[model samples]
Target chain A: MSQAVADRQETEERQTVGGRFARLMDMGDGALAFWLLLPTAVLLLAIIVYPVCRLIYTSFLSLSLTSGLPASFAGLQNYRDMFADPVFWSSFWNTVIITVVTVPGALVVGMALALIANIPFRQRWAFRLALLVPWALPLAFCGLIFAWFFQSDYGIVNDVLRRLGLPTVIWFNSYAWATVAICLTTIWKTSSFMALIILAGLQTIPRSLYEAAEIDGAGRVRQFFEITLPLLRPAIAVALIFRTITALQTFDIPYTMTRGGPGTSTVTLAMYIRQNTVDFLDLGYGSALAVAMFALSMIVTVFYLRMIRRGA
Target chain B: MKYGKTVLLALAGAVSMLPLQNASAETLHVFMHSYDMNLWQAVFDKYEASHKGIDIKVTVGGNTSEQQAQYLNTQMSAKDSTLDIINLDVVRPAQFAAAKWIMPLNDDLDGGTKYLDRYLSAYSKANVIDGEVAALPSRADAMMLFYRKDLLKKYDIDPPKTWSELSADAKKIQKQEGGDLQGLSFQGAAIEGAVCTFLLPYWSTGHTLVDKDGKLTFDMDAAVDSLKLWKGFVDDGVAPKNVAEIATDDTRQDFQRGAAIFAVEWPYAWNHFQNDADTAVKDKVGIVALPAVEGGKSATCLGGWQWGVSAYSNHKKDAVELTKYLASREVSKYIAIHGSLLPTFEDLYTDADVTKAVPWFADLLPVVQSAHARPVTPRYNEVSNAIRTTVNAVLAGQTSPEQGASQMQARLQRILR
Candidate 1:
């Protein structure tokens, strides 16, 4: 009997405390909003803000695993070393090149595929399913598949070229062709995702606009240029921003296909960071590299936001 | 009230059973690469079957040594205690010992130096650090020349002992075969094998990459000659035009499929050639020490795996016991017969069962005895990268041999100093 009474008293006390907190939240709308967002703010701090701060802090130290020396403060030394390193410059340029080439390449391919899929057909679900397949494939798997396809001796591309009475190209051995191959693969893997996003934008365009344009004698090409392109700007912007960010961080495809070979010509900044942190076990230098990558991403994202705001 | 009491009693029972279950079977986790997982799993199962109340859990790692090292290094650096035993590549024991990630095994073994006499001297020496045994050799490997025995006999040519003769023989065979048959296939890609590829010819010039003290003692002219020799093969149509893209497995695949007349590969390819279902070169393959540079001695690179007990393992004593069993001559002979993995023990090389399984093991003793290890230093990865990238660059026609050698020297000097 005494245990039952104690449990009831504890339950009532908890209810009263919760009720008091709820009443306190009801004092103002601003306070209610703050209370509602506290959990998310706490989570974001724990996951993102804490790690970023640690990364920045570690970047200012000299922590080399192979050296067998204790870590010591070395302000700006890693950054100084990075600026003087030729490999860093080369990898940075390669990352920029990947972003510049693949983003526009995917956009064009994706636009065509999106328009094709938007056509009214009875079996439209099949077309939609096909669009999802490549987008759903793993990046590393795509890299491996394309690597086999582009192999010098027995690759299907060279085989086809041989059958066509053309000279076959060595895909992965040459710097120019290796970069082209990885860029081509990145476009192929990512274009379908862009297509899916644009398809959603295509659905929002009312049929009445196309109908009015058709009645006004506007050709298919003209209507597409004016109406479709104009109406799809927002979706394209979103896809471009997302794709550009990912392109700057490209690692898996090139890693699987070339492993940053041919004299490290295809190495991206992310791969350089991996080589430093994981391969060489130079945490301080790798953290600095990461901070540079983070800054690059932030600048690119901010530029896109500004452009979007201005366009709006 | 009665229901609540019963629920509490049930929770207490479940909590108490956890310790009982743990006490019944002590689990030891062993991590190794996926390539040897099945064969090693059999050994683990044998150990588990013999030892009651002990459960052995195996974790398979990546395909490449570099990949496995990266994964293990990350885990060990974080002091992860989950992995009780680790299999390290031959090049990594020194680095792991320097970092104190692996425990010294002298205390566990019976005055460990006594047991060292059972294995090949070079491999056994690789595990000893500061008069303490840091690891025990599990298997041994070395680069060798793999040729089509049928083709050599058809041409009435003996296995070439010099690089020029080998090249001449390869070109002659290519001319005779006459239809898209590549003369040679070797790993020229920027990877771990490329380091051995660079070191093979360089070592033939009677130069050690690093002195016994782990100090750089590189010979630039010899390095240039080594670079030029590999580049010449590609340039003169002796090797594939895109040989720069070929990795270790690529050469293995090419040789196994009979696409190449000669290949430089590890001993593992011998097993595949003799046994694999898809091999076209079955009963047609021959192995020899890699061809020497003219007027220089023949040398091949040493490679093997080792067993190390993790410093962070809670069950260190049990892990060392398991390591001993795995490294025993009995287990080594079983692996030699079953998996065709070269045993580290000298007697196993001459064991009747092993010799019957791998007939060439009788001649392999000299090669294994003289094989050179890569530069043993904590900065070995950087050293390896420097050499491999230079080799790749020279082979890909991106840099001249002279330029690549100088560049490699500059990079290695900076790293080593």
Candidate 2:
């Protein structure tokens, strides 16, 4: 073709692109917002939606990686097997027990820390920084550290108990004690995070409310219960939801410390899922367990949301 | 325009360096447990030095078998080609072979059966699966009874030959060394070693967890007796009350620090006890076979690592060659001298250098030869979990030995089925 014809074709292409740009610029706010967000929406669909769908689909199959059998659809067989699995129930109860114990334990301890840190002081920033240290530490690192700290023979806890002339308790040998150790570690690791969030909420409370309570002749405890606790509901809810979800998915501490030991006594749902998928190579059953865990988390989230809405 | 020229020149230079990166050499990546990274890296470096144009990149995985297996499982499941060679624990080869994640060495090793004979007989037997060699032994290990020789001598007790004898000896030693002194230390945690802890006594009772056909040959009476033996120790204060928390390293560290009278551990601890600067038990530790049940013969759990060429590896030829070299008698002897790692080759056990460096290697050969590799099956992980967890439960006092045995039998049947 001639150079002039090529130039004309390029102009036409530029005009079309310019026209599309012009149209986009002329769009309404909602449509423009959607167009701008489409990339992220598609990305979310690919990464999050696809895997979740794959998980659900895989859960219905009998795809054992080491079984040397071809992948075949098994309908509800995986779920059926999981329901009958004694490990599933034990892990489920373990997860539930951990969540139930750790959430409140963290909230109370976090509130105490937040209240302590919130005090008007010259080195409040340093105090806050120190409070955030546990929050920033890696979960597995915390687990390992606590595992050593609670070591039956040379551990500091038993050593102190022995020094104090008290009978030393074995922290990780029995199920109840192992569970307690795990809960203590989880609370220690997570309470700081909860405190940070609750501290943010604590700062947001108008001093006028506290002042009014003080003027009404309220004591420190009464003011905390009446003003601080009531006003801190939203922050507490948010913190609780985050903490509860993570608590339900507890893996690191129990794994590093007990490895769901003392007979699967402290194996959380997440650890059991890993045991199936990674250790046993039973992907189908693992997926089923994962889906159950996901459903449980979703139900808890929904319940919290509904409760929050009712409160509002 | 002048600034644009510099930017373009910089971009051109960067692009030019890209090919230089690829032009270096063929890289063979090796994945291994972190416990002996330095020793393995030395072996790899030796291979690299000899075999020019080949770069061996080593990826150190976690120390525990579970941790190593978890990482490899994910990588192999994804058909990751980046990892060409993997060092697997003894129990993992069957699982890895069943998953088809590793290549069969029969064709590569020139009809691998004859090549397998180069290693100790048990390791040689373990390498073959369904008439194919799945992996070759890199080292040899077996659970051995490590005792305080000085303490036993001071207390006028010989090495215990049976579980009851061991218990009595431990109690006697503990009584004499009362303050903060424990009788025994062994792995009771929910780790791979715990399976051995359970199997040691069970095997002593003349029972195997599985039959020749990989069938569940779990003897309830024997298993219960085995569990009861461990529980009795914890209950009677022969072992620590919190024995369930002890892992492989815990036992080693406890015994090394002079906190325990005896430790049930692998051969690796021999080096640490005799060489480490802080070891209180150095020159005082003695190695022997694990104690048997009252009327039964002595037994131990076999352990060691094996080398496998990944099926997904792009450089299978190079990887196989490296594995062949690593599994050779020359490297085995070197490891024996340098790392004090037991050699897979039977002849290396008697080699003058190995015997001089590790005098007990010659004696360990017989124990290792007779040591049982935990029921070779694709479902060995599940089998291990069943036995280890039930053993832990009995030790933890969560269930009676009878209940634990029954639970284990049920779990094994389901797993085998």
Candidate 3:
């Protein structure tokens, strides 16, 4: 009977040991963290990383919706064709123009508005709210509004020009003019976003700096140049980066307005990619073009990150 | 085991009867490009009344063909079954049908159905891609040359039957009219409308993207001449340079305002030209088939919308029924008269009510009968884009006609390969 009792105790001891081992495993810090983050990690893998990697992989294949079979490896033929394509190069230049013009154009307007918002005046909040109206409107709606405002025949812009005894030029017929017009529209809409960011930066600057500068025989412009300008650099850099990216990926405004018209004078990389993939169904070539665009965007991002870091 | 089997049988029976019970609460959604919404509303009203307990909701998705196609792509590419019916542009059937994005209507159209024979040959052929009738035509339109009848009468000129004649007449009219009135206006914008505008000359000259031998047939001399002719409109001071930015509606506006003596447009502009409050030249507009070039024939590019059933629709039966109802002769006649659209039904052209109501149908019927469909390939959108870009280049003075033709041929070859 004593031996039987000992055996029962031994069995109980082994059971406790097993349970403790399992509990120890569960208590591991890395294991707990992994379990906690598994869902989000899986989600990112499925949606973002998977699609991106698959696109990169697809760039090396001869797959098309028309082929309807196992995809063949294409190597670098698509890239070769893309590099040699005149349309691609021309569109790239167009994208560069849109970006270069819109970025600084918006920045100047935004900086001016930000300074105005920083003014210690009555109804300052109302001014800020009003400034944000353009930014808050949907992009497509803004495009339509601008299209109506700039159309050649009945647009208000031409009407005003004619009424004011100025020459009425067709806004979207010529290549250079169409680009300039769309860039101006982009700047008009996006300037509000940049202003809001700069306004936030403006508020963070200490009042003491301006006051001290003013007391030291510095004019208002001098104070702005020294204190406000230097302090606002980081915010401007960040805003410029976002604005550049937005310009690089612009699709809706120009699409809705002119549809990359005047013989593809405004076809950006995104539109080109869409034309090849969605419109043309040339998946392989489109994926190659898409990867190239992603790489270009990455370069721009890296440059901006450095600029932001240096400014900060 | 017996109890479980009895419960299983009961569950199966209940599930089988669920549809019948829910039939009274059936609802359907139809997605289409926005045109005349009042006509569509009336058609839907009659349908809803005829079928008790079935409610239909109509959604106007997009305004232009490109926007509509893109919107549908966004919704349906992910196998979304939420949309039961889709109204497609005529050029969309080949692509959509080949992608299996739409359900084939062979079974529905077969079995002693006279519906297949009722539409014009071009209309019927447009819906059938790869031996499958995947959509039914709902509306029909054709590119037409609208000239000011009063201006022509004053100028003592018949409607110009050729491009050279039209150009010469336009010069004479512009010189005589001489007060903010230009010679001609045509859509040269870099959109789908531009493709249709370009195709009129290409087809009228007997050149096409694809020939009978399955050859890339874009390298014809007639095609090159057609491109040059379009550019000539600008160089010769006929169409204004700003026409390169004009869309269809803008062209119609200029013509209706009497700002131009001639306009190349579609039939949808007829009612507006005749009835708009601001119409300056009402009852004085006349249309003809788009003029041909020397040693070639005259033709018009067909433009219209079709109804396709979504392959993934859960309500296929209801969708098919609705499609048939929408394409019926009675309904087509009603739409043709009320919407100011050409009827897809063959007999509607002769229907006394329709003919009497429009009065222009008698003149328009011949043009509609000879309307040329765009390239019926699965890559139609891309092909059409190439055509538009090429023509736009010539018109925009970016490329010569010969260079544009070669570039078009090369681009089309690359895409088709």
Candidate 4:
């Protein structure tokens, strides 16, 4: 009976020590998590939340530099004026067109490039590196180069077309074509980013699945649809989200190449905001437009997440 | 021990604060747009040589007028005393003046009249907003026609003296000396350059985009006729369709590459055209005034910068002195030699050395003497942007001149009100 009691006491002591050690480990993990997250939280609040809140507050007020005072409360007048402004509507439509045209187009081209780069070829590495060149180049520089290439009088593209006995089309003068040209520039500049993302997803797919598909008599096209695409859902969602958000905010290319020109056909929402705030010195209206843009981007994010979840 | 530690910490804090305090003293800061930095550098060099005790620091702010205005507004709103002097564009003086972000030189300074007498009367008057000289004109520039003399000689045609005659001549040259060479080229880009260089002809033709009362006045028959003439140039293959998107640099390169017989450009291109290493048409180029418009006189659009002392600046007096010195004829002539800036001073325009150095200035001086400033208003930037947008719309055929003009008028009315 004495030996039995001693063994039970020893077992209880071991159990107590193990339980205390587990609690201490848990506390350490909690501390580590707090340390890791504090900087990010502070940074987000400083860089993002504060600026957004300030912008929102500014939007509700009539601010003028000449007045030399804090912006006066103007209620919803700025928002009301925005809706009634035709230029705003035109720019809104242009932003929509750019988003619609560039997002899906970039995704498809990017996926195609990712697939080609994934394949076993002699020049696969070279092709992959070359694909990144456009995205790596500065947007302004690319715009300048494209401007030269599209010159109606002496641009190389026109020269080549003329040599082939084709009618030279002015790329920027025609209202419809200028938008297309801008969209093309956006696609060329951003597709490599999508490809890089999709390529990473492609790498994550198991080799065994393709082997199994081949054993099941699945053709290359069938394999792609069955094995590759279904597995690439997460990547596609991420890429589409990224590309859509960026495409909606397309400014530098159109601003540099077209300046929303040929009658504001290429003026995106961001361009309109810049013009109102900077060119016209209408800060109240510009802030309202910025708020609208932020709201639209948020709505797009929510819609994308819902669609992504449903697809998954 | 605790007291000793506290003392060390306090000493460290004081050391750190010392640099900040010293940074606040002795330096006079100036802000200017990127393109004007060359002229500013020369002026600063001269000022530094003259003022031994004071230091001048300069910052190049932005590339576009809009960018510059926005940056200045933000800095001034923040009450940044470091921004001591600002270089504003001539068209934008009223906007800055209305805000009172800049000092009124006429009230604060002596010898203002003598300084004012050196500039062209129109330019000097344009800087006067609300009965104060808000800024002083530093440099002046205007657009002129640059033609390939050899090409004209080869085609056996005279340089065009009128828009109609120019159109005819352009077509004749295009037909006779056939290659990829266009008869004429100008900025058609949907930027301010297009409105300045391209639409000035239309305005010169007795068409005004905005009336003196600030109403949209772009839909007159003369304006439509002007648009049709521009379109005809494109249609007849005298001007390229892509000219609508050409930038200033792109247009310059096209002219340099011998792609066009005539180029409508600013005086900045004269040095490039004269330098044999930089241009193919070095000796073959000739400069002339823009052709007259039908039933109206030829008008050149004024392009230049003005110097203003910032209200936020603690060194306002020094800034004013610097501006006055920069605007003096001696400094203006030095700038003309070093930076190729067209002298804003009338005396410098007549200087024999300047005439010899930039012979084209002899032709451009008369043009500048009669150059037209864009409407002088506090909202000139907005007005100019609206004009550019409307003209671009008309040129692109997205909207008729009437519709665009009407829309612009409506927008301007709202802005004015």
Candidate 5:
């Protein structure tokens, strides 16, 4: 009872900051609240907001590294050039396609892995480690390992296919296959992360509820559908949003495997921006593309958040 | 109050001159990449030993051309006076010269810059853009065609002298030798090497990206035929099917793996092919210039490095003298013998000492003689990117050679304008 009291007091102290913020906000104590938020607000303004605003500002200028002239404001001409660039559209589509394929694929696989890992197996901890190994590997190492597996000449993937009398395809040789290969590599690396998050959500469900459903003559599938999934919605939503953002910003696997080659089929917007900014030294244009990407990501994230809120 | 302020100002000025008197060391900050660091350090030490109150402070970048470009672009564009000299790519002299980032060497190069005449004409001419010798030729490299002498002898064939003959022999060899051995391998990835490989045919056929007047002289017919030949190398299953994805390093490794009959590579591959210990074709390999295009002139893509003084350098005299010393015959000979680099000096090609150290330097002379530098334009980055994309598209089979040529024309127009 004393420990419970201590816990309640601790919770209250945690809430004191929140409560003070709410009360201060409600009572129109603008000065006090501003003073309280000064550090955080300044940090955000400098670190995050300033760079973004600079990028947006740079987007409207003509800055060339190879030239001696000072930068002049072009005012949406960079945007116009971006839209006119076919390479930009191709990279945009590549990012979209990779996200569309990898997110759902990871989710489904992750859900299955989470369920399997949650089963009453004797070596469940060992199984968990086995499943988590892919996520543990660094993303660059994962890309290189996958590249070796899918390498056309002597890679084990093709070797297995050839042994099985299946026609082997050159993995990173075409627009379609290179995109597919990148997606596969990304999904393999990221699904473990999704599973770890979803598994945590699965552990939070009350055991009594499942037992009661079992006693009420509910089949395994019915119990899963009725008791498990509905309660798991928040976890799935969180996982989905996290994975989607990561997938949208995909760079490592594609860049490492293909270097945006085979005719720029696997280049994400990140790669395109890098090529323009660093490789081509077109900083102004690259920053414009970066700003556009940020805006698109924001819109998508908002849409996803709204959908999640409605679903819950 | 005015008298007191004047006294304070005089004291401050006198105080500022104290450090100037104590440390009057003149430092030349040299920007270079470590192709041969030991040789550079030794040369710097030798120079610093002879000259007092002058030190050569070297800044080294790792061997990524991108990093070099970024470093120079950042430092030079800001007009930073700290960097006194730059070891730049041969192809970049025009761009840097046009932008006034690197200084012209006319007044400093040994009284009228007569040292330029001692270097190979092709490489020396590469440094001169718009009547200004903006850079000093520091090193020389050219493409060489390496082939298996044993395979040619076994197949009862002479070395090919033209593209048609080369393709015909490659097809026959592939038919007889089976799929275990690929006929040819070359860099076709959308990077710089692709341009080098593609340039052989394009320039051999006497096609230049720009005319003598610097106008875009993109000939569609020659470009299509050139690209068609490249695509045919893959389509006919002589080169690897995934040739579109191979970089220069991959080409070297593939050839080293004894997986290809012939490979187009730079002079750097010679030592690796002979002495890498794992090379199965160590004694079996021989090199020749790339085959001509039947009716076209013989051509090879020249590649190397050049040294230039920074326009914003504080010690311009020291920087220029340092460049001259770095490219001196002693240094070039040392680089050639020790670093496996081709000396930029024309006389070193026939030097008995160099030939004693490396027997194959003799054969490289004719290839270097006829070698053409890639288009010397201020818009080289844009132009090269456009060509790389077009040729890469053809290699990927995304577009036909003719279509790629048309795309090239469009992109070149937008950029050249």
Candidate 6:
């Protein structure tokens, strides 16, 4: 009875502190809040907002890299030209296909690895560390290694296939398979990152819950679907968000491996923007493409956030 | 009253010294890419030691065409006088000249045209647009055939004199050598280097990207034949199926590792092939011109960098002097020996000391003599990209060469307008 009274007193004290804080906010103590946020706000404004606005503004103008003259107002012509450009549409579709393929594939594989790692075993630590090696390696270095591995003639991949009496695959020449090869590299490099996140989520579920489910005649698979999956929703959503964003902006691997192809087969949206802005030096058109990419990313982000909220 | 008078006297004295300050503060700022910074520093040091009273501040940008474009555009747009001199790629001088961001050398500076004429004929012509000499050639590079002399001797095959001979010889060598060694290698990737090395054979066969009237002509049968020949190597198994993905460096490394019998590359590879530490074929490599197509003529594509004065420069005279110094024979020889850059002057190719130092130049000069520049236009980048895309499509078997050529022509026409 004394302990219960002590708990009630503590609850009342917390409520009183919260009430005072709410009253301060109601009385326009927002100034104190603004002061605390001012530095971060300024940083975001300078780094993010200003550059985006400038890029959008530049997209509306006619500019060339060679001439440093102020761009004349081009209005919507640059955007219109981009729509007519087959390279832009092809790369946009490529980005979508890669994102769609790699995201779900990574999630499934990641979850499986996480479950395997979560099981108590003699070498669980070793298995977990080994799984993370792919993720831990720097992306550009991995890309270089993949470039060598996929070489059609001298590469180990082709050599092994040839020895097995299988026809050699020309990785960069075949459009469909080249894209698959690139996607495989991305999935290999990124699945571990997702697995790590899922593993953390898996650890958070109580062992007593599983024991109770087993006592209630629920099998391991059924318990996983009914309880474990529902609890892992937040972690899966976070993984999807990160993987989708990264896959959408995939550049370095394709760049280092195939360089947007034998015939622009694997040119992602990021590579398209880079080629136009940097290689071709059409800043206005490049900026317009950048704006399009920015808009697309925001839409996807908003959709993911809503899904996460509904799942919660 | 006395304190106020004393303060006014001091201010007056400081004001009187302002002219001296202005006179002594003259400095010319130069913006160059990172690769050229060291060479430029050497040249600048020499200049500074000999000529006093002029200070130069150097800034290095990223070593890419994109970084160069950004730095030039941003700095020039701001009317910043600090970015006085710019180092430009071969294809870009015409575009920059047309844009008027760079000064018209013949009109703005003294002895510009005469100084430019000292460069190789084709290189000098690359910088001229609308009767303006916009830049001076600083360095020159042309593609050459690098072959394994040891492999040739062991296989009992002589250096190929023509395209047909090269193909036949490559096939024979590939048949005999059972290991990872391939017969021939070149850049077939869909990038700038591929176009540089492969287009030479095409151009030598009298195929051109554009005509005199700026009309697109790459859709001709010769262009298709050229594409077919380049793709033929992969189909015949003389070149690897991954040839379409091999970069210039990759192809060079393959030859250096004795995995390839022959390679089409630039002079830079000569030094690498001769370097004992990196190459298995060291002291066994031979240089030759690209073989002629159809027992006819041969050509090489010209690749190099040039120096130009920015139009926004406040110190035009100083910038011009610096450019002239860079183009001087002494500096050219210094770069050849230390920097491994090929000189653009004709005399340097024949100089006994230079030939003794490089040795490869004796054979490289003949190739450079017949080297062709890509179509010079304000829209050359667009044209070059279109050609590369279409050619790559053909090479990858995504489209027929004839269809790809027609598409390239259409794109070229659109850009030319």
Interface RMSD values for all candidates = 1.4, 1.2, 2.4, 2.9, 2.3, 3.4
Question: Measured against the native two-chain assembly using Cα atoms, what DockQ does each of the candidate structures obtain, in the order listed?
Answer: 0.45, 0.55, 0.33, 0.33, 0.29, 0.24
Task: Using DockQ as the measure, name the better of candidate 1 and candidate 2.
Answer: 2
Best by DockQ: 2
Sort the candidates on lDDT, descending order.
Answer: 1, 2, 5, 3, 6, 4
- Which portions of model 5 show Cα errors greater than 4 Å? A1-28, B1-60, B64-85, B98-107, B110-115, B129-132, B153-156, B174-179, B212-214, B253-259, B274-276, B282-284, B310-317, B337-340, B355-366, B396-399
The whole-model lDDT of each prediction reads: 0.90, 0.89, 0.84, 0.79, 0.84, 0.80
Give the B-chain TM-score of model 1: 0.95
TM-score of the first chain of model 5: 0.89
Show model 4 residue runs off by greater than 4 Å.
Answer: A1-53, A64-70, A114-169, A188-220, A226-228, A278-281, A309-312, B1-50, B54-80, B111-118, B146-161, B205-219, B248-261, B275-288, B333-366, B393-404
User: Fnat of each prediction?
Assistant: 0.59, 0.80, 0.38, 0.59, 0.41, 0.41
What lDDT tens digits, residue by residue, belong to model 3 across residues B1-417?
Answer: 999999999999999998778776577889986778888989999999998767888777779898788777667657788888899999988888877889988887654224567788778878877677889988888888999999999979999999889999999988887776778898787778888777777887777768744457774676687788889889888988876767888898888888998898888898998888999988899988888887788988888889999998888998899998998888888987886799887778888999888987877788888888777777777788888887786788767889888777777786676
Query: What TM-score does structure 5 among the candidates reach?
Result: 0.85
lDDT of 2 by residue, A1-312 (tens): 999999997778658978678778888999999989999999999999999999999999989998777889999988878887788899999999999999999999999999999999999999999998999999999999999999887999899999999998777778888888899999999999999999999999999998998999999999999989999999999999999988888999998998787887778899999989888889998999999999999999999999999999
TM-score for each model: 0.85, 0.85, 0.82, 0.79, 0.85, 0.78
For model 5, which pairs clash?
none
User: Which lDDT tens digits does candidate 1 get at residues B1-417?
Assistant: 999999999999999998888669889999998886688889989999998777999887788988898888789889999999999999988888877889999878886767787889988889997777989999998899999999999999999999999899999999998987888899998889999999999999999988988789989999999999999999879998888878999999999999998999998888899889999999999999999999999999999999999999999989999999988988989988888788898888888889998888889989999999988887778888888988887888877899989989977886787
Please tell me how candidate 3 rates in CAPRI terms: acceptable
Q: In model 6, what lDDT does residue B91 have?
A: 82
Q: What is the interface RMSD of candidate 6, in Å?
A: 3.4
- Chain A alone, model 1, TM-score? 0.93
Q: Candidate 2 — which residues are off by over 4 angstroms?
A: A1-44, A112-131, A153-165, A196-229, B1-27, B33-57, B151-156, B176-181, B257-259, B278-285, B333-340, B347-365
> Could you give the DockQ of candidate 1?
0.45
Candidate order by DockQ, highest to lowest?
2, 1, 3, 4, 5, 6
For B1-417, candidate 4 gives per-residue lDDT tens digits of: 999999999999999998787655367787776764666676778788778656788787777665687787678756788887788877778888877788889866566544476678877877877668889887898888889999889878888888778888888887777777887887766666766854666668766656666555544566556656666676677887656666676777888878888888887776676763868778888888888877778888888888888888887877888777766788788878766779987777768888777665665678998887777777776666776777677666677656765676667666666
